[model samples]
Target: MEFALAALFELFESLDQCAPGSRAATLQALQACEGLAPGARIVDFGCGPGPATVALAQAGYAVTAVDRHGPFIETVRRRAAAAGVGDRVTAIVGDMRAPDFADGAFDAVWSEGAAYSVGVPAALAAWRRLLAPAGWLVLSELCWREGARSAEAAAFWQREYPDMGDVTQLEARCAAAGYAVRGGFWLPADAWAAYYGPLEAAVPAVRARHPQAEAQAALDDIGREIALWRRFGGEFGYRFVVAQRG
Candidate 1:
């Protein structure tokens, strides 16, 4: 289990790209939110390498992109600068389960699939405290209903997000967290196909180039996970969320 997760992390961190294109989806979701204006203060809970961060900054929002990894933070900062939005963006190294921001300091917060690495419920509970009045929160999480948990699926996610719950339960939990669940959209399946498919196919070359590295192994593991999803993705639900603080 630990090996799979470590491999998965290595694969993701090494990629110049990430999917389920949560970055693009989060940007689209945030566009539908209110009170996001020029200079609106926002924080990304687990922003990796600055896709949504770059987008948010490009859209004229004052953005703080946070991730626990120093390399990711540096990547985001460098990318933001190259994109010419560096002055408007801030990249920090911090974890979601224990973020390093002040209470009621941000008007918005964002999270991608990175929330699953920690625990979503705990992250939601902790970070909701940092939001200002009526602040917005956007999430792109992978989930499956409790009843839909097959032995195979359970085994698959047991190492992924063992704490994952269904979409309805997520709605209820967010509601209880003083939030108003606005809406959710199923992520574009074609995007997933495009990303994961090539990633799987890249294994051989990646293996040949760095046989001892975890990247190849992790990509293979994810490919297996994708194959499992192809078989039973119908039983699970993942999406983009827009929620407002109550």
Candidate 2:
């Protein structure tokens, strides 16, 4: 498990993004978060490599970017500095599931394509206390799209994310977790391409470096994930949800 995790971390460490997202999509979600003026306090959970963190800081928010990985947190700090938003961004190596901030400390909580690390329901429930009254919670989660699903895709997600559900079910989860459903949108196919393109290009070099069985298994898992998206993408996608603390 340690060898596999090391291989996974090495493979993903240099990518500009750790997930399927774009600056455009991040800004779009920001726009959906009404009433937050410039310099609003925002906390980014599971902020791998700080793509969204820098974007939010660029948009004039004071952002606290949190991730468990030390290297990724350092990358966030470097990116924020390079982007000229270092003063506005605070990068920390910490668990998203149990951030150490005081209750009601933020105007918004942002996470892009990383909420699944802890189940979305648990995330929604746990993170709600960090938001100020009526503060926004924005996140993108992998979810089943409406209509037919291929057996292969179904099996893949069932094994990988057994708690996965449709958008409506997700919305219900938000409400159940004490948030008011604001709105959501589907991430485009190019979003996936953006994340996978560099990842696919980097795989061969990583495989060559880490020639152990566990490392190879990790690489194979990533390959299979990418291939599954190519074959059955329409059945599942990342849904960006904007909910306000109720």
**lDDT values of the candidates?**
0.76, 0.93
**lDDT score of residue 46 within candidate 1:** 79
Model 2 scores worst on lDDT over the 10 consecutive residues at 117-126
In candidate 2, what are the lDDT values of residues 96-203, reduced to their tens digit? 888799999999999998888988878888899999999999999999999999999999889988989999999999999999989999999998999999999999
lDDT of 1 by residue, 1-246 (tens): 555455555555665446566456656787778767778898987788767788888888899988887878888888899999999998888777888788988989887677777777787888898999889988877877446567888888887767777788788878987889988877777756655776676555555655544555665666788898798777776667789988
Q: Provide C-alpha RMSD values for all models, in order.
A: 3.1, 0.8
Misplaced by over 4 Å in model 1 are: 1-10, 22-24, 145-151, 209-219
Number of the top lDDT candidate: 2
Clashing pairs in 1: none
Model 2: clashing residue pairs? none
- Stretches > 4 Å off in candidate 2: none
